[model samples]
Target: MTMQNPVRPLLTPLLAALVLAGCATAPPSLDKALPQTPAAFSEGGVPWTTAAPAEAQARGEWWKAFGDAQLDALVERAERGSTSIQVAAARLAQARAVLGATDANRALQVGLGAGASREAQRGLGVAPNTVLSAGAQLSYELDLFGRLAKASDAAALDVRSREALLRSTRLLVQAQIAQSYFALRALDAEQTLVHGTVEAYRDTLRLTERRYAAGDVAELDLVRVRSEVAATESEALALERQRAQLEHAIALLAGEPASGFRIAADDWRATPPQVPAGVPSTVLARRPDVSAAQSALLAAQARVGVAQAAWFPNLALTASGGFASSELSELFRSSARAWGIGALLSLPLLDGGRREAGVANARAELDAALAGYREQVLVAFKDVEDELAALRLLARQGDAQGQAVDAAARATTLSETRYRNGLVSQLELLDARRSELRNRREALQVRSAQYQSTVRLIRALGGGWGEAA
Candidate 1:
């Protein structure tokens, strides 16, 4: 007797053609370095530059840049306590696990199974028997078209990108915590200033009231002094509220309940950290966000190779072995062993443009990633330039404002002397007092702005806390 098969002959030539076609397409070479002349450098602004003392602080502990023990402790606590950082770390671990899974696919998969059964004899005289079977199977892809390699590469890149994302989250958390801490300190300073001003006004008001009672000054003068006292008291109250809000913000960043955490009221004498000069090219690597973007680009590039690889055939090797025995004791015996091996060829000969669309989409994604990477570099440059300009302009403004404050102080002293000699009215003396107060407040604001600008510069230069004077 002869048997005939229809499907076997039909499948042979198609599989052969797929294998032949796959061999024709070459594997792509992935360049680790980005293309020269990144899109970031094309647009002109302030040439990105860093300026700092030649002897710079270590980068490993950039937070020490501010040289504040309290700040250093706060940052370290925030890093450990932050829920957002934990989430990012978990995501990175998940990505690495996924990479491991993909890598496992590139190697052979082996499995073992076992089964046992007992049966009674039928009326037809079949014998009662216990049956036992054990089996082993193995399967693996040959990766003849580099498809597995590309997929594993893409997964690895994704893992790296997620790791970079975690780093970016850490950097963001550090900066936010520091800024909030500084803001809280600034508010504390402002409150102290307001309270002192209130005390001075209270003293002045008491003197005016006494003088008015003695018929030495008008009642209107006492009322004016009382009003200044009220205004300063109001500002002090507002500052207390503002400081509370800053405290709450800091607590949230530190992953603690606002009620559970409190910052001690230290005098706001801690100076902004000194910024270090980093190389322009180094900025691209130092900024966590930019590094994340670059990692994403690398991942996307790897995906392109994966998508392209799909256009080729998949080659696989399959093998299976099993043992069977009618008697339980015979299972896994030498006579029961068996094994076989075969190769498989698979190809997507025709789809409704699906494979082509995949390739196109992957290419588009690569383009987008490259563009985003370039954009990040450009933004990094702009941030540095903006801080540089701000530092320069603020220093000049601070100098001029200091001069104005000094002149107002002198004018206040002269006016006080004039009033004592009856050369000026009480109103003129009040006017001079008010002018000096306004000048002093403005000067304080200028100083705060200059300090904050320096802080911005330090962050832009990537850590190195400034020393306190």
Candidate 2:
């Protein structure tokens, strides 16, 4: 005990050194929270907007921005049924419960226990003795070294980080549902175009066969028309396959059997919902992933205090009060009462530099967390920038494709009229029909691309996952 006395005396000074070193390092303040300046695109004429959402806070239902009733229902279903979201929610709840438990009991700990025993001694005055005893134990750890405070702070930060992770998971699920829903609708548009093309090809084949029978066109023109019809039929089958696959994906997202679920075929239009791009600073707080990253940093920061607190001595007070008697009838009597109190001061002895190593590890972890946070912010900025660029470029392409479709439709009408009047060959009529079909298909693709791009933009903005359930 005397040899250990010297070791105990040096503990206070070491603890003081640790506390000073650990708490002194503050988290670096980030002024430029979000990235605003976008990378320049190769296409020189596209105007990229920097406007993000005006609301820095997240809303609950982000799918409503698409103005699609079906999409809104699907997102709701996904939120309710998604296993990943449920897991994340459960984790958040666990973290909150842990924080509550740590906070509520930090000041006091109490326990009650009872015991009964029988003892026999031949040499004693009484041949047999029986004792029954009950005791209440109370122990409280004084936060003299701020260890409990730091532990509570770390636990609270863990709750915040867990909540942020839940939000991030929700946002991801919403984005996937939106993207899949739009892609399924796009397939519908492609199927419609394919059917329309098949009809036009059939009509052209009929006209070509009639002219060939009347000696106005060769047999090869009739064969070419029939071949185009067959090809368009094949395109319709391929589109249907893609549509079914998308349907299955959506069903899986909603946590339902794909066999019984279906989305009705709907018209595809290029008018996607207009989302305002807010300032870059808003993205840091609004985006769930970014929020999660920052919360993780906060958690790491709190842990540094926890590590530093290990240097200080822990002060514990314990007391026990109980009633005891050898006779059952006298167990609760005043003469049978017994009480005691104790104070424990646990000072660390030499541990081969383990405490110092702990502080070093905590500092390293904090540095890594800070770096990871910065990386996430950079990735989020790039995501928004990429989506913004895609939207602008696709909008222009859709416009140009619309014009081409109109020109091809007019040209097809003129070619057919000329063929009927014997002013052009069957080849010219077939060419015009093919051109119209190609332009129409391109137009549908462009419209679909635009809608998909809008969905991407909403996802990058965190999809309003911050609402309370």
lDDT of each: 0.73, 0.78
Top-scoring candidate (TM-score): 2
Worst 10 residues of 2 by lDDT: 39-48
Best by lDDT: 2
RMSD per candidate (Å) reads: 5.3, 4.5
Prediction 2 global C-alpha lDDT: 0.78
Q: For residues 1-469, could you state the per-residue lDDT of candidate 1 as single tens digits?
A: 8787888886775677567555644335434433343433222232333333221223466656567888889989898899899999999999999999999998889999888898986797887787788888899989876778878888887777787677667767887887787777777777777787777678778777878899988888888888888887888899898888888888888898999889998876676654443233345535666667777887787787677777677778989999989877777699988778999877776789997798789889887887888777667666767776776677788788888878887987898788667787777777777777777777767667766666565555454333311
Across 1-469, the per-residue lDDT of candidate 2 in tens digits comes to 3346677766666666656655655556644543444443223333334434332355667677567888889999998888889899999999999988888757678899888999997776777778999889999989876667777887887887788788778788888898898888877877887798789888888878888889978888889888889988998998899989989988888888899998889875435777553332344446767767777777787787777777767778999999998888988899999999999977676789998898899889878878888888788767767777887789889889999999999999999999889898878988898899889888878887887877777777666433411
- Candidate 1 lDDT trough over 10 residues, lowest sum: 49-58
For model 1, the stretches where C-alpha displacement exceeds 4 angstroms are 1-58, 117-130, 276-281, 464-469
Candidate 2 residue 175 Cα shift, in angstroms, is: 2.4
